[model samples]
Target: MSFQAYLDNIQAKTGKSPSDFKALAEKMGFTLNGKIKPDVKATQITDWLKAEFDLGHGHAMAVYALLKGKKPD
Candidate 1:
């Protein structure tokens, strides 16, 4: 799937936009100022996504890509 497709599916499943996830990540200290923190590991974010949103590894990685400033192509 395309990057946007992954994000769209995630939103459809979780009722949250990427922006919402970013905000929540910030609150969780996984991110700051809309960016993933330097000290944060991808697994930490992926694990949280899995636990909280029931997202699969690929879907969780999609969110991680977004946090890393990846744009859909």
Candidate 2:
């Protein structure tokens, strides 16, 4: 599937867009100023998304990609 397809499925399943995840991440101190915090590991973020959003590894990684400044395809 395409990258956007993964994002779409995630949104459909979680009822949250990428922007929403960013906001949530900030609230949880996983991110700051619209970027992933220097002290936060990718695994930490992926674990959070997996546990909280019921996302699989790949889907969680997509969110990580976004947090790392990857523009959506």
On a 0 to 100 scale, what is the lDDT of residue 42 in model 2?
94
**Candidate 2 lDDT over residue span 1-73, tens digit each:** 8888888999999999989988999999998899888989999999999999999999999999887888778
lDDT of 1 by residue, 5-42 (tens): 99999999999998998899999999888888899999
Worst 10 residues of 1 by lDDT: 64-73
Q: What is the lDDT of residue 66 in candidate 1?
A: 93
RMSD of 1: 0.9
Best by lDDT: 1
- Estimate the TM-score for candidate 1: 0.95
lDDT of each: 0.94, 0.92
Task: Give the winner by TM-score.
Answer: 1
TM-score each candidate: 0.95, 0.94
